[model samples]
Target: MNGQVNARAGASGKAGEKVLIADDEPNIVVSLEFMMKREGFHVLVARDGLGALEAIRREHPRLVLLDATMPGMTGFDVCEAVRSDVDTRDTRIVMLTAKGRETDKARGVGAGADAYVTKPFSTRDLVQTVKEMMARDAAE
Candidate 1:
């Protein structure tokens, strides 16, 4: 899916800020969508890096939860692309991945990810992180 809006939230007529969840895993996408929607965000889903990038440009979500491993492009590559693009340069990106090595983290940061989160992550902590990041973005 390129930028499929969550149907439930779409019909609710009061979806809040946009947050894009870019992951290939169905379970992860569903869970994250639930969590973000509960937090009052208008959730958008993308199944791969390219779709995520397209959605970011097309939809201009407030933040993106990006996955490192996908079919066409890696999250690192997508992050770099977003950072490099003048129009979407300021879009906040949080890299969520199973690659927990120090070098992998460093690479994620080096690629311009605002934050890097490893898998097997705490949902509460992730929500808190997302809130903090969005708050910071708003304050700026």
Candidate 2:
């Protein structure tokens, strides 16, 4: 219908959401950052739990994709820490890990994570989960 169609009309769509990707694996970080950016989310990377915490403080992202295992602080530890902090307590957290065991998922939820996605996952799944969390947050 036009050379350059700009049909989008929403404030949320214009600002774009910010998502922090915390993972010890460099490849995972790079891949997730690329995919999130392509999806129009501002992406921040943290290589460890400490780094994750720092990034959270600095970025104040709308959502966090946290890893279950890391050098200093595990995902559970990170989630717990974030939940305890008054400033970041409201931030949405999603555990991303290779640990697919039921116990691990339970642990993540117990630590204040909103969702859990196992490794070797499709980018579509990850993006969908993040969007769902954002939507749920908006409703709350």
Candidate 3:
């Protein structure tokens, strides 16, 4: 497949699932977009925090790969906003950032993020984790 989208046939595959990747780095966004699209997920991109929040509201993606540091709102703010909104509270969030400190991880979790992945992470691990996450209850 030449970087084009592909939706798998019915039932088990997570084809067409929506995943929003919010990050400011162009390289990161481009790579993440390509990897996620290859996995059959409908991809959405937001370069900053506020745009991320808007995309979350408008797109209602099943999962979000959120960056803690961006131009405006920050991933923590976006996660907090999603967690507070009853309509969007169930949306899954994975805090992806360079900040790998224990406190940073704690804050991400405190803001209701479902998972945390540090920068330079394994794409294979990320994809597999995302699949496992999608299989779990969103509310949990």
For model 2, the stretches where C-alpha displacement exceeds 4 angstroms are 1-16
Best by lDDT: 1
Per-residue lDDT of candidate 1, residues 3-72 (tens digit)? 4433335334243368899999999998998888888887888898888888888888888999999868
Candidate 3, TM-score vs. the true structure? 0.86
Per-candidate TM-score against the hidden true structure: 0.91, 0.85, 0.86
Q: What TM-score would you give candidate 2 relative to the actual structure? A: 0.85
Question: Backbone clashes in each candidate structure, one number apiece?
Answer: 0, 0, 0
Order the candidates by TM-score, highest first.
Answer: 1, 3, 2
Please give the lDDT score at residue 37 for candidate 2.
72
Off by over 4 Å in 3: 1-16, 138-140
Q: Which ten residues in a row have the lowest lDDT in candidate 2?
A: 1-10
For residues 46-109, could you state the per-residue lDDT of candidate 2 as single tens digits? 7788888877876678899999998777889989999999999988998999999999999999
Please say which candidate is ahead in TM-score: 1 or 3.
1
Which residue pairs collide in model 1, if any?
none
Best by TM-score: 1
Query: Quick one: ranking by lDDT, best first?
Result: 1, 3, 2
In lDDT terms, how accurate is model 2?
Answer: 0.80
* 2-94 per-residue lDDT for model 3 (tens digits): 112222222332533788888888899788877887777778788888888887887678899999998868899999999999888989899
> Each candidate: RMSD to true structure?
2.3, 8.9, 5.6
